[model samples]
Target: MKKFWNWKNQAQTENSPAERTLFLNGTIAEESWFDDDVTPQLFKDELNAGEGDITVWINSPGGDCVAAAQIYNMLSNYKGKVTVKIDGIAASAASVIAMAGKEVLMSPVSMLMIHNPMTIAMGDHAEMQKAIDMLAEVKESIINAYVLKTGLSRAKLSHLMDSETWMNANKAVELGFADGTLTRDNGGAENSNMEDAVEAVMFSSRAVNNALQNKISAKYGKQKQTVVQQSEIPAPETNERNVDALLERLDIIKNHI
Candidate 1:
């Protein structure tokens, strides 16, 4: 009898002791769209793999509201602790995902933008009115997420969402959008150069103004002058130095005659 090997079971058995952390990046679209294929599988695998804290880093511009809501719920309900780090920007649906984190962090330069949910539809007036009503309900769902995360009043949260609020890392911390600031350098040299360039421009502008003022003062101080001279008339005489001069005088006399 030959021994049979089970690779799938063997690998799972070996890896079960180690904790796994999955990374989710990019836009969140509709459940029937691209997100369904990627997010659900990843979530299922990560959830089943091991019992460990999951840290999710988000820098998305946001997409389908429904997909974002689903992903948010999944993370929020996960048994293990979830931490979210916003390394760059988290806008629209991305912001909703951030709310799922038990502890949220944001880099100094990272930003968050939130707004009312929206969609386009073409139909009769009644159908259009229904679409408007649907959008209002979706907006409420989004507002609920923010209210849950921030613990702010629903009315206040709804107002901010309606206006499409933008929050920096510090503002995010203050408003409870982010729990705290993360210590991550986004490369300091570029920022230093930008500051230096601004200073140089300001100094150059001052130098130009000083030069213009000096020129204006100098123009007022300087006196204009006009000089003229009349020379005494000298008697006309023929040149006796060379034969060429004599020939030239003879040609002039001939022409005059």
Candidate 2:
């Protein structure tokens, strides 16, 4: 767990009337970026702040992939609904973080870019091959996240990533990268269906749910394992039923349009 910025301290010293208490902002490319100790703490504090939706403000050029992944997981597994707002740009690993949000909201001028994972490696031909294989595996994992969030075809998503696609707010929403654009006038009504999808996804994969639990326990340094019992797991049939119901709802909405 990393806490890169002391957002609370900054807020106290430089209070802004327009700032929401739950809004968090950080730059991934700046020096001292991705401070492991500070970023996680801020996220924890916000998560524990009571029962309500959270808005995460991102304006990053992207940095440490591991750190970004951890933070993204934390937000995704949180009990409350999480909305991500890309205020400026979310590139590379930052794009992964954006996908973790329950409902992604972007400013009209915001941008998002995604590309294949990259890493520096020093090794022989065999070792280099291994590195390449690992990178491919990692890319698949990242692509799964995007597919789960957007319900987009894997082939299309892979093509976009390969092209290092850059998306504007309208394009993002059209492509399912974002739920919608945010208005300066007010924070609009939260979407109940989006909230349900977030909760459903948390319970959909046993591995993901377990990983999240382990991360939380490690964060608190608790020896006790928080195991989700088999009976608690959502059945595959139930998931299919939910999806069918969602599709029906969408069809009804379309009829009204």
Candidate 3:
């Protein structure tokens, strides 16, 4: 079975602290956790082998929510401080694991995404309902993790998940998904030119959507006010309603990407 995590021990230096580092890269738990018992045992053994602070470097698209949940629990209960550093993208189930961190930091160009839990089910109406109920419970459990880390209300977090929110580093920090952005002064020297190039490409899609939203709002704001004043019509209710609907549609479009 392919391991999802890699471990390394860094010796203490004159200027830096000694800590174990774990890399969680690529798709998490590409193999099902329930397939065999060895994987979890090996992961737990490696995690418990050392003492002192540990830093987890995450760059995953996310997979296998059950595996992520087990990892999160282990890290949360560990004796040493757990620091999570997102160096690329942490989305879906990976975002749940990130909440186990005592301090979560994202690279300036890193991305984090959260969405409602999903599953495949094929059966009669009763089975379909059971699947839906299961997913709802799973999403609630995931929200519990987010609530603990971000202090965001369950309703707000649920809405974000419903919309499949994607956040950049600054936004992540603002929303409490991350403590802060990593920087050279903060011992983050791993970000290189190549990573920046990749970030540029990945971030462009979101940038365009944001720009479009702003442009539409700005152009319509003035027009809406002008129409109301010229016609003496009670346009606020209608215009506001339509604007909200339009923005919701835009969000739906953006989320699909």
Best prediction by TM-score:
3
Model 1 alpha-carbon drift over 4 Å, by segment: 1-19, 34-42, 184-257
Pairs in steric clash, model 1:
none
**Per-residue lDDT tens digits of candidate 3, residues 1-257?**
78879988745567665679999999988976856578888899888877789999999999988888999999999998999999999999999999999999888878999988988999999999999999999999999999999999999999888767888887787788888777674654532323333332223344567688788877887777788899997854433444546788878999996
Report the candidate with higher TM-score, 2 versus 3.
3
Ranking by TM-score: 3, 1, 2
lDDT over C-alpha atoms for residue 241 of model 2: 33
Candidate 1 residue lDDT tens string, 29-133: 534533346555554554555565676778788887877787788888888788887888888988998899998887767788887888889999999999999
RMSD of 3: 9.0
- Residue-level error in angstroms, candidate 3, position 115: 0.2
TM-score of candidate 3 to 2 decimals: 0.72
Candidate 2 on 1-257: residue-level lDDT in tens? 33333332223223332233344345553443345566556656755654545567787777767666776787788776777878888778888888988889877667887878889899799999999998998889889878988899989988787766777777777778888775565555332223322221111233456577667646543322123243565434433333334556777999996
**Candidate 1 — what's its lDDT?**
0.67
